[model samples]
Target: MSKAKPLSDAQPTQRKGAPLPTDPGQTGYGAPPPAPLPGAPSTPLTGTRQRGGARPVGWNSPSSRRPPQFTDTTPAAPVRRLPQPVLVSAAVVGVVALIGAAILGYRAMDTFDTVANPLANPSAKQTEVPLAPPRPTVTVTATPVPDAVRVKQNGLYKAGKVAAVNCTAPAVKPSTEAAALRFYQAILPCLNRAWAPLVRKAGYEFRPPKVVLWAKGQTSCTGEPTDVAFYCGDAETITMRGDQDSKLFRQDATSGRIHAMDTLAHEYGHHVQMLTNILISSSSRKGWAKTEPAKLEESRRLELQASCLGAAFLGANKTALGITGQRLETWEWQTKHSGDEYNPKKVRDHGSRKNNWLWSGASFKTTNPASCNTFTAPAAKVS
Candidate 1:
């Protein structure tokens, strides 16, 4: 059988600072137009007069009446000029009146909306509404519902793209078992909604994995529940040990809510693996997983993929889930603590903190699962 090739190594850098964690055999990883200026009321041409005409400063009262065709001895009446003090006062009054008229004209101009006034620009044509440019006519060529053969070869990559989800982040207070259980249960539907449709489209029978919210004392496919959280591929169940989980998933932000999401979603990521047959296919692979380095490599790919898938969901639904950039940045930085380096025995079962975040950052930047194809990436990148 053809195993997935090592994918491209185009991962982004993990931002430093808030949330990552551990679990037994499984359950691990976590990771928002300028109006055009209308022609200025043509600046109302300074010299041009407006309508409401009183006729241009008429010189001819009755047309050519002219000074009665004469020059005039009437100059005697005109020679009686006003007294100097009165003339001065009248001059001052005229000045004040001119200033008042200027002020009023300015005020009227200030309130006038030249664009709205049609007469403002008689040359202007009707705007014609531009018909919205026909919305660019989206000729959606459906990606041909990838066949089973395509799904087998491409795996999750065949699922194509997804839009961000409308998932409300459940208010969770860590260290409280009930809240932890509720938190896990709350996001299950969202996780289901994210992966189910894609599975069905892939020509695979889709069944959501079981989620045991308070399975601290319960049994999982792995037998006794020793881990804080795990996904039992054998039974298709996602079981959580609430009490121990509260203590372990103790990420302080949102009362440790984000930390819980990372852990739960990481496990859910495993569920995606099972649904896509990647986990099953991995188990049956030869030489690659048999050697120690190869084993860790495979493990990292798997775990990191979980990180990516889980983050993809969170990223998709971040707005509705109240996940802020600050929160995610903090989470990326803290992911370093979850690396195999932190393990007491120094076993690299999960992956390097950098790789954990590398995959996560890649997937979080988009709602697409195909980007999480760590199986096709080079070993150095995953390391």
Candidate 2:
């Protein structure tokens, strides 16, 4: 009792078996040490505490006590990733967009190919789609073949039928060269009238031949000396050797006139051959022959056909040309004399006498151009 010291400054007495202050600031045996001032460094806790003004080993100073830190040890639920349905929906959208683009590109390409390339789609069916303004149909017509060309291919020999010739005998006689030329000139119109229709019917162009009366001159065609009478297809002219044929006129006046007429008719037959393309066809065949015999046979056929054609003309115009039975016989005899049999040593170009007489007589008897198809006749007949 020293007057109990002022309680504020009192020092408490320890008591046995009494509870000690639980506050950490109390310096009791079991109490924790006081914390250090704020902002001071912290000390790690140990098992033991220091004695006599020393702090406990585990005590943290006030300076080291920082604001309460949130460590987030619970791990914040792992940021809850996007919902499963949303993620799946996004992936599906991306795939659908890619497929749609691919389909659109394929359709565009198909349309372009269909429009640009028809052959590219070989398997495409025409029936699938109707074409606008349907494709046009084309029609072709063949050209008509000419009769001359047909004859070369062994077609109808006489392309068409000949009509009857209406003519009258000319008054001019062949007693002299002047008379013979005048007689020939007078008969030309009749011959033209007789043959023109037949040639036109046969699909050939007809032109009356030009006549040339020469004396010992060369022919325009073969440059051969004009002996008696010849048809030159090169100049399309009939050359008559007035000097040579006039001797026949002196021998027998009436017979010479007939001979002259016969000669003109025979030479005109060559003109018919020319217009009918017979000479061209025969020459081509002759040049292609491999042997002399074949060439001779072809030549005989050509000459015999010409003789036949001559007889056809003479027979058709018998009344106008003064061709009586006697004159016809004489004409046939002339053809016989022109045969290769007359001179066996020469090439047998003109046929045998018998064949020549047969063809000429056939023409005189029938008076048909169709009867003059020597090209189709047998070798024996042509020979």
Candidate 3:
């Protein structure tokens, strides 16, 4: 150009009016220049802004990259829990204990019988041997005595009939008389039957004794207000003051028909003695009014034997009279009357309670009069 300017001077000296073009490739001293930004088009190098700019690598550019920015808030940490190893170990121990308990439970069912052969160890076995094919227990119930059966055995005689007495004229019973009359009536057939055999076999005259039921503290068999109710051999009649017959009737009736039957049967027993003429004391031919101890003792024997006779009568007729309502009444009466004999302290002695019970039980077991004979029994064994 203008006289082909000298190489150095023509390139740089007079360039104040215009800007020089950049030699991007050679500007970095052999390092390659950076490429243009992604959206920029290819063009001459000059002072141009980049689309989304990156800084130039020069003294003015920052040397260190900025650190990443952070917010002030922090996230919460998770809660800690029991260690898995400890939990697993405890679960394993529980399973082992459960299995052990199950094993022990199975063993306890056989009564804890560890012995293999129970028969081989006699000492170890229980004394009560367990029965094979166990049998049902059989319970025996006593049958009840019946009135018809009593009639067949001892006749119509009531056990305590000798204890009655008449108080008023005509010796009739008061309105309370129904029970006593019925009682006597009930005993008639039974006494007739009982004494018939004895009278025919022994050749003894049979005469039923009269019964007098009157109130106590009124005129009575002894002619005074005595509580005594007894058979009067002198009058050939039984006198029962109101205190006794009324009480008996009320008690027997309230106790029920069956109990009344027993009481009637007991009274009738005295009639049996009278017909047999056995009631009069051998020591006192006149009667029981004598003060002799022997006479009193004889009275007691008669009373007791009559009680046994009553039981015998019941046992013999258990199937006939149908002692149903108060089935146990006869048994109770027999047991009660047994003790009326030989008691010195008692106003009227028949027998001891033990004797009453014994003779009654004996008579039922053995109908023979000999079984009821207490006179021959040892003093200690009699009752």
Candidate 4:
């Protein structure tokens, strides 16, 4: 687990945020950004591997959905608008925020948001540069590995089972910056502990990726002054705001812990993909860039998988985190709102709020990584 780092005017950037839901239709955060006005340059985004026997061979799949696709033509993220609730709350937020209220237009917003909008606005943090690609893609195949090992056919779908984790909840005021950092610091190790078992379960040699809580400036993935917590495979790090704003902060501290923990766990899920070899293989799939619709679908699969992996970890460790009764209810409600549907854009990146929560619900219910086999689910499930 990496420690917190403060950005300076001269320091380079990295991108990923738990953003503020600023879009008109957004419920919480994690919405697809506006399509570049028209002619903006595009960005590309990876796949998965294994250990021991079979090397690249696969086992029976969880679903029989058609093969997932891949692409390298993700368009430049569009400008984002501030949501009503966030706008109203901003007036009373802390004065210590180095970032200011979201600028009107697509120009700049000091921070992004949480949970749902982890990678929502790439361009939101930076003025001209686009956010990095959203995620890798996946296709389905219920059959055994047919000579090659593809993301959809990877053993992680069923074999990469997650062991129950025992998380020690860090006590803090959920809405404060100090609290955010403390919680993140406390939870990352738990996440590492939770997901590390997948390597042996799936026969992959896996290790944990660094998790960074950034205050400002560019990130490896987005190159923006982003607030959303995103996983950057390039830097092999997850960059998020030390200040927890977003719907998570909107709740009482108890509820906020669930959201904050989930946010960090979600980014860590991307690390699971990297170790599993799903991230890179997904991109190498044939004809991944054939259509924009397919690209969005692929992004959804990648993100939704992260959502499920995170949920499985948290759910299995609910007792340790004190997630029961109302606290559990808070998590369910928030996830339902964490989707691309909230963004109100024609292009959806992270799937709908309903699906986002649904996938999370599906995983936690069983606490099984196999339950997160989005790679084999039909299009409707991922969407």
What does the lDDT read for residue 356 in candidate 4?
A: 80
Q: What lDDT tens digits, residue by residue, belong to model 2 across residues 93-124? A: 99999999999999988677654676765455
- Superposed Cα RMSD, model 1: 30.8
What TM-scores do the predictions have? Answer: 0.56, 0.57, 0.43, 0.57
Ranking by lDDT: 2, 4, 1, 3
User: For residue 5, what is the lDDT in candidate 1?
Assistant: 10
Number of colliding residue pairs in each model: 11, 7, 42, 49
lDDT string, candidate 3, 1-383, tens digits: 00001111110000365643445443322232445456554552343332333334443333223222233234435567889999999999999999999889987665555476567553455659776897899999999544223322333232312111111111223225555555555555664565456554544566666765544245544464443444555665655433334444355543333333444455555555555455433213326345655444554555666666656666666545554345555456535543434233343445466666777677755654555554445544432
Worst 10 residues of 2 by lDDT: 5-14
Candidate 3 local Cα displacement, residue 157, angstroms: 17
Better of 1 and 2 by TM-score: 2
lDDT by residue (tens digit), candidate 4, 1-383: 11111111111110685644343543443423234335433432222111121222113222223222234345545669899899777865754243443333234343445444667743335559776888888877787443225566666766645666666666655576666676677777777777766655777887777766665565446464443567787777877655543234654565556666777778787888888777666544423568888877777887888888888888888888877898888777777766654452334767777788778898887888888878788999888
What tens digits encode model 1's per-residue C-alpha lDDT throughout 105-203?
999999988778869844556687754555566787876433323323654676766455577767655567877778778888888887888777755
Candidate 2 wrong stretches, greater than 4 Å: 1-156, 226-228, 343-345
**Residue 197 lDDT in model 1?**
82
Positional deviation of 33 in candidate 3, in angstroms?
99
